[model samples]
Target: MDRPEKLLTTAQAAEHLGISRGTLARYARDGLLKPTLKLPTGHLRWSLEDLRRQMRELREQGGE
Candidate 1:
């Protein structure tokens, strides 16, 4: 059996990615990123692993 992955809140994810919460939300809105989970109440959650991958991609792209 595999353990469940712990998802992070928007603010936490933003901090980990070294970006503002607004920028993180904007990235999600613009389709540059997507929340790993969204509750029925509209709360968003992100995967830290995904954020790291995003950071790597951004660095590779020179943040263009």
Candidate 2:
């Protein structure tokens, strides 16, 4: 299978970071997480690298 190059949906990104969708949504709202693409269906998409960066930041902050 071919790997996707970029952009993950909220669910995928959350799963990768081992977080709930609600938490991801809140991060997005707080501007801690930014979307690379906003689909017509109102779904937010984030780059894999960006998601990983956010996860790293969260880990550093130790809020969980």
Candidate 3:
């Protein structure tokens, strides 16, 4: 079986989600989404699957 894709950086996650990097940071602050990991450099990363799930949930909730 193919291995799952690795976690993505804030920029990659933002682009994949079709949102701005600041928006992603805002979401993180608002507790709408959480990072999968925090690097030693203090950068945040997220799993593609988790990002997708958050998008779906937002859509279902009528995007607030």
Higher-ranked by TM-score: 1 or 3: 3
Q: What is candidate 3's lDDT per residue for 1-64, written digit by digit as tens?
A: 9997799998999999889998998888787887898889978899989888987898798874
Residue 60 lDDT, candidate 1, scale 0-100: 92
- Candidate 3 global CA lDDT score: 0.87
Q: For candidate 2, give the lDDT.
A: 0.81
Comparing 1 and 2 by lDDT, which wins? 1
lDDT of 2 at 53: 78
Alpha-carbon deviation at 13 in model 1, angstroms: 0.5
Question: Root-mean-square deviation of each candidate, in angstroms?
Answer: 2.0, 3.2, 1.8
**Total backbone clashes of model 2?**
0
Cα lDDT tens digits for candidate 1, 22-54: 998888887777789988988789999977887
Q: Which ten residues in a row have the lowest lDDT in candidate 3?
A: 55-64
Model 2: what TM-score? 0.70
